[model samples]
Target: MPVSASYRWSPFCVDGVTTVAVKTLKENAAEVEKKDLLSELEVMKSLDPHVNVVRFLGCCTDKDPIFVIIEYVNRGKLQTYLRNSRAERHYGNTHGKSNILTSGDLTSFMYQVAKGMDYLTSRGIIHRDLAARNILITDDHTCKVADFGFARDVVTSKIYERKSEGKLPIRWMATESLYDNIFSVKSDIWSFGILMWEIVTLGSTPYPGISAADVMRKVRDGYRLEKPEHCRRELYNIMYYCWSSDSNERPTFLEVVQMLDKLLHTEMDYIELERFPDHNYYNIVNLSGEKL
Candidate 1:
């Protein structure tokens, strides 16, 4: 669901065989919150459905608790799913599983996300927030881009400028986006690199132990995120391509898709999960805190 952190929601089963996710808001809720949800709904409605993008269902507005329905993803957030897979690898308990997440699976996930983003960018929609937590995994292991609350349609403007900022994604943001409030498809690509890092690292927090302010400062000073120990040089290079200091130097979503496609078709693995080092999951409850 494309909701803010304060939005309360839950999943319900239909006939005990199917499930659907619902985002509900009472009629008496603040106007800003309701407008946020409705705004996301409009963005979702503007695009054609894709296999890699979450499907939007119907909504109920003429009621006390307005409901926005969306296709339910069984595996939930990609970050949590990746973390669980890492746990399985850590404990050596990945048995009897036909679909244990492999290096290939991770590559496929990234490829799928790229394809989804490609579709969105082609439609002139910039997903201001593109990260692991905003993506969802399905029972069949397909990655779908979700949560369009921060998305904007730049079809006419070709760019989005932040008029008023409440909270911005600092760590995943591009250099221009961090330095200035400007956003574009290239900025989304920059965030994609960070998402690639999350997938390779099994949801490890980016710029671990650094404050959001420090992240902005370091990024502005030409400090890029280090490649994961298990990430291949070629894949890391692609990530570097996305994190270019100049937005114009960054690859387009289509170019990114093509690059990832080539990597996927290669016999060599780009990421080796077995080689991933053991590390504690850094949970950042507050992004504005001194340290993430």
Candidate 2:
């Protein structure tokens, strides 16, 4: 398997007016890579269109470099968006429209992700890797779940075990996944908690300053990430809930959606993204899992 591969942003006007992104595989991609791309295509084709999920446009498999076309998200990765927003605020860049987010904006992002995850779980799909980097942000700030390379269908069996060893998101992984290579909707929920942390921290890499080996040891020892300075206690509590050691204890995506919805409508702000310190420390990290 390739150490790192990303969908190329090849925007073309398919209809001479409407543009789309094409995910192209490398010219010399291995057989396993081709199979993975095909698997991703199958999964995307099976999914129904949802506001919070990236829309699959079409594909081209007859050619040497297979193409998996998808809807174009102008703002790009949510991780990059958040980091840029932080930079904008830090440097007082008022040249154009500000990207500084409000409490409602942040809450809406969390709610959108939960809704997307709910839809995927309903379709019996497990987004093995759920993080900010895998999510895309539209120009309107709508968050959509993207990247299905690690996704699996669990309609028949509720659990999926990894028999092959490869790169894993240890920092965002659940306890069972870390220890036994087991993956399920519950593990995705745990990763969602990490995603929430990323949102609040402006895309800070999880377990910042900690080594991968240390992250595994600490997570196994019942250690959880502390709440961010700008994160509210209530929101932090919700994140903590997602990190429950027992997978069964974690709330379903629907429940998470409900919680976030309620939080969004409430008078009290669950989090204040505008309060993020000017001297922010969060930065985008490699999503290739090579660091791990």
Candidate 3:
């Protein structure tokens, strides 16, 4: 079973102007593995659509080469965008119109991710591979969650269950997830914290000098990634909260949205969110889980 391969068409389109991304099993994948890929695709299709999530247009899994068509994000991966933007910020240091993100822009990214995360958590999905690299950016700077290859329905799980085994992104994972393969919403929140750090630092790699093996030991010993040098203390606090060893204490994605909402207001012009109730907009969802 070939575990790696993908095709991206330079001129792929749905209606001439409507661009899209098409995903399918690696051409070299064994016939036995096709079923696994199709099953996962079906699970992803069951998820309700949301702006924060990469929309799936359709799929064809009836035969040899199953394919799933999804939305095409113009700017590509969030990590790549941040890295390029960061370089541009240093090269010219342009103001007002530079692609460099302001604190306001950072908050916008956080808000969108949280909104999408809230939707996922609400629907019982656990994105085991949540990270900056898994997020796609559009030309308008809209961010969407991508790469659901590791997602599963863990909405009713009281505690994370260790994975049987797979290649996990250890750097962006929580301590429990690392040691036990256990995963849950809290695990996703931990990865979200790392993603936030990436955004604040304009795409600095997480744990620059730490090895995967040492990361588990360090985190278990109360070691957490320090705040990005340019991150505001308030925003850092939220990231810290997400990294709590007691997963039960970590705030739900909804709480994350509310806290980020407050920060966004403080950092820039406040806008009313019609989706949330006006009177109790700050009502945070407190999911019962272990504290990290």
Best by lDDT: 2
Q: State candidate 3's TM-score.
A: 0.84
**In model 3, which runs have C-alpha deviations exceeding 4 angstroms?**
1-11, 30-36, 93-97, 156-162, 268-292
lDDT of 3 by residue, 140-171 (tens): 87889877766776656645575445445776
RMSD of 3: 9.4
lDDT of 2 at 216: 87
Q: What is the lDDT of every predicted structure here?
A: 0.83, 0.84, 0.72
- In model 3, the Cα lDDT at residue 42 comes to 65
Q: TM-scores, in order shown?
A: 0.91, 0.93, 0.84
Instruction: Please give, for residues 1-292, the per-residue lDDT of candidate 2 as tens digits.
Output: 1124533557778669888888877666767767777888999999999999999988888877788889988888888888887777677765776768777888899999999999999999998889888899888889999988788888889789977666777888998998998999999999999999888887888887777788889999999998878788989999999999999999999999999988988888776666766454545355455432
> Once model 1 is optimally superposed onto the true structure by TM-score, how far is the C-alpha of residue 71 displaced, in angstroms?
0.3
CA RMSD of each candidate after superposition: 2.4, 2.5, 9.4
Per-residue CA lDDT of model 1 for 1-292, tens digit only, reads 3345557667888789767898877446776667767877888888888999998877887865677788888888898888777777767664585445788889899999999999998888999889998999988888999988778888999799977566677788988887788999999999999999988888878888777878889889989888778889999998999999989999998998999899988899888766777663464646553211
